[model samples]
Target chain A: MSDSDSPSAITWCAIIAATCLLLFLFQQILWLVVPFLLALALYYLLAPLNKKLVLSGLSPDFSAALLSGAFLLLSGAALLFIYPIAIAHASEWQIALLRYLEGGTRAIEGMIAMMQDKFVFLRDSDISNDARQNLMNFAEQFSDKHLGKVILTIAAWLPSILLAPIITYFLLKDGAQLRRFIGCTVPNAFFEKTLYLIYALDRTARLYFLGLIKVAAIDAAFLTIGLWLLGVPSALILGIISALLGWIPYIGPLMGLTLSIMVTATDFPGDMVLLYWVMGLFGVLRILDDFVFLPYIVGKSMHLHPLLTLLMFFVGEAIAGVAGLMLVIPILAMVMVLGETLEIILLDTRLRARHTYARNLHKRAVTRDLNIS
Target chain B: MLLNLTGKFQAFKGTETPQLTTMRGITLFSQVATNELRAIKGLLHRRTYIKDEIIFDEGEKGQAIYFIIDGKVLICKQGRPQDGAIAELGAGQCFGEMALIDNSPRMAQVRAAEDCTLDVLFREDFLGLIETHSRIASKLSLELARMMGERLRQTINSYVL
Candidate 1:
């Protein structure tokens, strides 16, 4: 009469079905959900600092307040000192980019002609011409159709972005109490497992976010140094963009390389020598990043298989575009942890016994009600 | 038919409620400061079980240590549930303390011999306290070690005699 024997396959199927339904509902409300999720990420990033301050003899409230104040001051400093410089650079970059695009088209045409001349096979082939035309069309379409819409969408999301800090502040201040309230709702047999799952998720998210920041900083430094040594214009800005893009995993590094190559192609124009050198530098740095820095600094925290990660990336992109691509890995990792933990608890004899007991009691009440009616 | 079997078992939820003061009497937490105990108390899960209810089964993974706040609990070896009652614990005594040190399957089953109230300290919460309050962690670990030593001495003495 073991409890584990009583819960049939139907129960497990029901649980999975319910989870999928809930996820579908969540996707429908993603606009509201995204801000809270961002706040939760911010809370995980900052909570440890608050805990350290408290451990050093400060009250939790005071620590949270101090950290929040410092964060606001830092944001203010960036706005005052960095925004003006960035805007000025953006205007220059816009003019430079337009000039580069015009020059780039001529460069591509010349390269195609040279390739066809050098390879007699290509001279007779129409494929080279078709490929060149496709590339030009893609660039033209992206610049004309997509870029403005992307900027407008970002402007639209500005109000929701403001809610993140306020949500994060309350989370940091009352995180434990909120956790306790959630914990209390769990049945006695599952209480410990729930606590363990929460702790594991928190640790995993904290390590992942911290590891990402470290990886980005290292990438930015390496790119900046490499570009500066190569005498590329606006090395700092390009390096920063590359580092930010690096967060997107496999596709991101390729995009960064392409951007660097375009800038190199523009600056050096017909200098294949300098373009090859820049490509070589980016290739070497990418190898170092993937093989050495990412493995050591990130340290397999997500434990996701590379193939599965790629699949998730594609699926996320299809579902919610770029934001989904960025968020899917962490969310999937968390869900995996939660599912495994819940499965263990659900299969536990004690929990099953409790459930069986409750179900029997419910049956008795239902039968009694039917008898009375 | 499962319902019939469960219906035959008498059920009375234990009335005892665990308080911070009760933690002072439990040997594992005795040396912890009052303020620290209050914090620890918040982490404990208080639960009441009916008589004949299975608290936990043998061979199941343990995640928490339980202190008996009221009534009695019977600990039995696997495969001899009816004949073997290895130990019976009452109020102030704790069982499953080894779970706090490491995650392992329970060596024995624990069932409520009578309606019982228990205060459970989960391993993760205990580790969390150890991170935040090492002093309290050290005190509890020392007490746990002392208790193990006493149990070992008693077992050896019984064998020698």
Candidate 2:
């Protein structure tokens, strides 16, 4: 058996403590970690382009610079053209939201009035009074607390956004040297396995990020065309929002659909037929996403069980909110791959023999010391 | 067949001038073109091992084929010095070629018989090359099959005698 297969209570305690310590350190440096992870994702997406360029006779530095230049140009174009239209649509949506809320309040009041007229007992009931008060309190708290905090967080993250492109460029430029440096650190016994694991992780992350970009683009295009056909205002903006939110897996697409429905309902208030059509469109798209796009594009890289996935989703949500929910699956998948690779290395007879030999040598030394004393 | 084997051994023995030239002399890579060899050079990892240093232990997972650049290597079933040694390969010879076909445990322990310089070709890189350059992969694969077949025929003849 491998030395790691059996551990005393003290060993278990030490392991747990070390894990907790690492987690605490991770939490403290999360600001750095978040941007680094984003940069790594970007690196994975852009590295293949750089490699292709280099393979075609361009120098590595030049290839990386060219890709970075292209990205900057694209971002500049989006800021110049798309940003203004999105901003204008956002303002329009804000106004529409207030109008919808006002209409909703009036409808609720009318329902309460009719209920009071029909049932004299409910007019004097504390339950009805409490429900109304609770709804008002919840809405006030959401606006005052959640919305402000979200805005503040985004403002804080603005500086970190600049780090991503710079990190991605360096990763593209010196990726081979960096990989070799890491490989050098691995023990000779586990070198091949470690290299295999690193390659597998790189492949998985690259495939996932590229697949996500493709899926997002397809989703955005499909939604924009469908919304335009349904005569929805600001279809482009709504489509972009849907595409961005679609990163969050099960919860994100639903949130995107609800937001689209709300905006559609506000623009064409009391049009029940139009609302039904929008809902139908989202349902059809959801089916397509689940059955076709996810299976075909994303492939079966994540071999996680559905129950474990849901549990992790809830745990992730509890720990880091929406970001956690989006990152959890990929992180878990990587961990699974790392664990399996390590298990193979650990189970190898030579590695186990080495461990056994070391343990025996230590034991013999300890016994000799005791006898000498 | 004996004369042909002797002639090939003599060729290897005579051409120990440079590692790259000797690599071409090896039967497994004899058919590979110069441009293909240049491409394959990028995947080769060169390492120097001192005398008596263990290259790899028996029953350990093997993922690379090693080409002898200089000096000699001992292939033994057990780790102890000269215990059950099957071969003492010199410069221009290669070992662990079976690893290129499958990621199974090493059948024999490999140790440096003298100070040795070797080029290692890992299976992952080999697989990657197969995906990108099918022509090179096919040529190498064909040569490897022929080498294996020759060895199998020799082993069967020895057993019959």
Candidate 3:
């Protein structure tokens, strides 16, 4: 039997169904959804600073406006500075990408040769030469077919992504008013409970997102320092990208490992020793993340089982692809909270009876002065 | 006729509703200025209860204090009959103030003795006030402490006599 506090199977199904539906809808409007999600993250990140400002006697509206304006100015200046430099070096960067791809292909060939040498049956079969040819072809095809599309997609995202700060400013300034509006709309019989639910949902999202930022910061620091010490080129950029990718759970860390391996192989083609060290570094990072950082930082915020998390990852990917992967956990966590709260409210016979009584009371009062007789 | 219409128009435009007027006389808000009271009004929620309706059950976790704006309410111990109500409170009086300090199970149940309207101030909003408007919060806190002390003295006197 399920614990009393735990949601029933029907509630769980509803939660999952709601999550999938929302994910599908989000995938359709990904441009808007992406910026909105970013704004939510920014809101949580800056909320503490806003709270401090409020405590220091600034009105929420003034504090939010100040923070949003400062963020816009800082980001705009950085973009202006970087835009010219990025354009000037665009062709050089493309060539550098191809070189890295070629280096990665060679590293694979080297591994194949070493494996074939160790296994006499493989050496006799000409597997190394065949694999080398296949790797070279695949690398060339990827650069030719996918590179331009990737750049175009990023360009398209830039304008919509700028909406994040504006949305965050509104959220900070009017969040309480929005909450008050919602409370006012609910029937008085359910007012307090509804307010408590809103408070709980806000707290859950805030803690989980803030915890994620802390975990990412820790991962980036560890990887950057490790890669720099090991002489990996562009170590800081690689570390940050990998740390971000790590947000997607099992698949994310694996993708990060693949990226680091490719970069290390490209930068130091002949060094199997360094390649092994890079692999070992990621392996340790994976272990530490699974055991230490996640549990300590994120803790019970998700309150989801590991098996359920893994299953949802596949379901999310199947429904919305990469966007699904990114959106699923947060959506699921929120739906879970909603479903559980609704279940408790629906099952509370006393509360339901009280609501009915109040409704009838209101009806009688309204009719008392009528002249139906 | 022209003057009466203008007076009615002014009443509609004014900030002081009947409930706000009742709130102004509440002992807990005695020292608060009109501007500060308006700010506090934003943090209060209005609820109405029918006669004999249970507002809250004893042992339920308390999250807010309720001040009657009209009509009356009965404060009673759970498992006691209607005739055994411990206190009958009228307009301008408040109950559940202890919840502002802690989230303890309510010490007693409350029911409407007649059709009533109340303004509720939640603990979360109160704490937020403490953060942003400490001066107003301090005055309210002092009144709350004084009220509690007065009640304690009355209880001790009853026992001693």
Candidate 4:
């Protein structure tokens, strides 16, 4: 965003191309990428605390170790406390979940019936019957066909998730050393600009992730308050789950709404009014998120045009499916930072000339002593 | 083996690299204590330049102040051949100090008179110190202000005469 190095049209194209390529590559090694991304977000979340410790006279190594240790202990303690409660309610949750699924199926059937009543064409056609049959089949086969697959996927992800803390620890500790290593590779003429580029890239990523966390927190609070007011049971948990699910852009909000509808239907059975209210609440939240929360928070941090953002989501989905949809914006933000800085460095005639001059000077200096000998 | 390793560790800990020694001698860092200097050292980057290599050009955006560790450098103006070199600076001296305060374009070009080593402190790192290590930053800032004031006085004197 620096005026001195405004990105050119070619640079913009390159950034988009690189982002798509990286997204495709990321999908190929998604297990590693997912954990690495989680670690990056965790690192940014814990960085300010680690920085405070360092400023208080603790060595970076010591601060990183201390922070990581405390995080592990806290996680372990929370797990220990929650595991027993979860185990006790396991059967209850399973039955509730099954009931909710059935409720969701029924809600869909009701909506179709209502539509058919409103439109004689729908009632006459096979669309309503076909949809009803599909819903019934899905509900019946969900536990038998898909539950094991879901469980297996989670089990596979466990070890990769465990890598997050280790990656975060190193990032906290040796971040400066890594930066210095990168700096060492550049020639003297480009060193300062390269250093600034590194700083800009780091700032962009941190701002984006922090903005996302802020948006998520705001969404959760509003949802929790709304659900509580509506007399929904376990409103806090449901709100939190819905807000987390809302991270996946277009598909995520829809999924969250479906979840809320399922819970609302099951909790207040035969109450079409509650279902309608829940749908209305989600519709309002979606409006607020799109127009208010997203524009001011995540959108501001990225500095990307709304049209480009929408296009990228589709391009990302086409290229790498869901992973691309989730990763595109962050990837584009990073690529923009890199592309802009690189364009400045490459396009500057003086800087490139200075580098060439420095090389020539070095060559002369070496030969000056050699010729005398 | 433990005793020998401990002895080696003590030896290593007691020694200061030449760059750090040179940094201590510079007027900008003169008020900084050894411990504070060590803290600031983490923010410094050292690079070597061959003789006659242009360090930075006139009118270029400045981002860092460089302290000379070895050899000398010439500060000159571009397209002012008659004026010749304005100043030749040697070891323990620093140039581009004004960059630490603002990102204004450089007023003069600087080139190495001889092969040299320098430790660079970037403006962002110095600003970071202002937030986290105020005392050290204030001391360095005071020294910088005093140096700039002296330079301003000389320029005034030259004009008055």
Candidate 5:
């Protein structure tokens, strides 16, 4: 272990505290960091296409603008269609939640009584009847106070939301220029090696994010159709919700599974076949995710050990819950890559100016000796 | 096998870029301040070149200024009537800029030392821009004067040394 002396420890503590305090104070900036980072990520992803487009007679500005416009229109159209449905479903889910909870509680109590021992799922976390009622009342009161403002806030940010494509357009346009600008900034000695590291990290980030998207899409397809077949109402809705939530690693899938089971119970009530099928199908998809999906898709590039992944997930959850869980692994990958780059840059003086100069001098001296001989 | 890694090859691994490193900043807009550069960079034209490819040869008539966005470029003059290369261009420095003001033979040969990309603005269009915005003429003229002064100073220093 790298133990620190008292003075160093104090310094370290101060550093960490300052960092955390800065992060806490600049939470909005942190959100902006995601979008900016995402824009860079988008820049990388669309670089090849933009290059091709430029080569094919479209100007970079035109290419970036055109592509950004198309993307914005598509996603905007999607959100425009999807938002109202999602909001409606969400409201319906919330209102019916009491009846659902009450029904779910009674059903669970019944199942526990019926099984008497076997089913481990519904045997725990029994909210008391009076407590459950109070909770429902509280939920209603909270919704009454908060829901309108929440909807309005999301709706009000429409203009800003529309600005994303414009931001994306500039990123794609300047992306190549920015990258080259960074390269020109590198010293001669370490430029190639540094470029290599950047290239590797860029490749890894692109692959992992793209793989996640692919897997999520597949997961959505399988879950939605499967749910529909099982006669589970709002299968598309649930599937999409599950797909979105499932980005949260281990916790997300389990949460999705529990909710699906609960919803199934509300309608079907006692249908074990459909329940097993849903569980079993999801179980297989997950197994496929671990065994088949990830190996080929993201592979070991996101090679945090399970122990590390779990730790990161929880730590992220602790900090910012689901959003953190989704983002932390990618962030961890970035940090690791950055750390690696820093180590190479800082520790390896052979790659720096003085060393490079010395090497050149030595080579020249050796060449002179050879000529003299 | 890794011989000839020099001669202005791509940057090495484990390198950090200097803050003031001059990229091949293509400046067709002299009237456009640093402020405007930030805003209108979105509208610039971008181009790319492979390693060792000629961007524009020395004394070749070309009409565009080039920005060194990534990779490496060698701005070499056929030293004193085709003797040898005199200088290498790195990132963040602008070149072919004089063309935006005047359509003349290139002063030096520009080549990509590595796979490079550049944002280019053509002289014809840029001059048209200058024509409409006459304020640009004054500003650009001042800039051209400053650049010429720097060049003259460098030349004097070289001859004196």
Candidate 6:
């Protein structure tokens, strides 16, 4: 018989199709919902403080605003306080990088000649025949096409980048009302449970995600400052670049370590000192992040398998590029919350109906006895 | 406006209104109405009856329509079971509307089947409910008449069938 005629198979197929259709329809509302999810996470984390503030005679809204203001002050104060040091570190590293590039070109020429003959290097590498020919062409093309626009684009996007705190502030202030609004939108049959799941997943996402951002920033700072102090030329520049790469998770830190080793090796030939020092620093940090930081930060919020987490990251990267990778975990967390709640609601309804049926049957039996008597 | 909130309601013998809210999003009008109806239910005084208590004997003036909000009240005519049930109802149902509207005497005996609650909407309250929810009242009237008609036919046909 056709599967359509078979009972169980048809129901399964129907359910899957319906779920996909619902996902597509609700895609636009995800953005509005996402910030509130973060708000709820902050709400949970900051709730005890909020409650104490309430006991001290503050309204809920005022406490929310004060806490939000505190968070903003911390972030803004951080940018203000840390930026000058970071910029100095970056400028010093930049100068060191220019010096490295000058000497490194000669070292590259030697490597290219060796690679072209023995390593079967790409054709662009064999600059031996006319090494002087390409320098002007490369510089001219780079300036004309890419350099200025990159600087301009970064400046243009800076203000919007600063808007995250503003968004966080509003989310904190109105987060509970926002949740209730969303809850009200759910059919009453599923409202309370659905809200619970969303709140749970939201807390998990904040724990894992907000913690990772801090970890990445700290890693970048550690490497940059260490490189600067090591008297390693261009140390700060390379440190940040490597740390940013390491933020990619498992495979990334390996790439970062290799890059740091390669760059440092060139600056101080056979200077195993810089290479091993940087490696050990990152290794210890990584251990802290993976063990103490990650567990406490992300904890059991998602309950996703490691393999699934990796898969989601890659799929997210493929679809949305860099922003995709940053966003997918929270989005996945949200979908999980919704799916779990929907299942519970469906199960509850069926159970209730069964209960009512049994009650009706009992009433019928009672009626029969009365008639007999 | 369908039912007055101030007047007392005649009930069975000893039952009272239970304190509960109906679950939400039930598509049935009866379910939604029951929840809204409870807001005015406090003005509705209740009484209960034992299993064999005669709620109303036949030929008595039917001055009110008893709402069986919970438990069953049996409608036993002098002779029949099926014909009697057609005149009675359980939770979320009501009866005695004919006398309620047209000023007639009770056509059948209403006795308590168990300890039961009846929210009796007297002539004034019954008319108030009909005025407020004419649509529900009309739907109810049609269904009630259809049921009584079906029972009359069944009893009339019993001689031959």
Judged by DockQ, which candidate is best? Answer: 4
Real A-B contacts recovered, model 6? 0.00
lDDT of 6 by residue, A126-175 (tens): 36646534633443454456545875776665555455455655665555
Fnat value of model 1: 0.08
Candidate 2 per-residue lDDT, tens place, A261-306, comes to 6677667766656767877888888899878997799776665557
lDDT per residue as tens, model 4, A39-97: 88888889878866655555667679888778767767886897799779867976777
Worst 10 residues of 4 chain A by lDDT: A51-60
Native-to-model Cα distance after best TM-score fit, residue B45 in candidate 6, in Å: 32
lDDT for position A21 in model 6 = 44
TM-score of each: 0.75, 0.71, 0.85, 0.88, 0.57, 0.48
Write model 3 residue lDDT over B1-161, tens digit each, in one string.
97975574444434465655777978899897655675677678778888877788788778889988889999998746366688899988899998899878889988888999888888877886886688889999999999999989998999999
Cα shift from native, residue A204, model 2 (Å): 3.1
Candidate 6 DockQ score? 0.01
Per-candidate DockQ versus the true complex?
0.09, 0.09, 0.14, 0.33, 0.02, 0.01
TM-score of 6: 0.48
Task: lDDT for model 1, please.
Answer: 0.73
Candidate 6: CAPRI quality band: incorrect
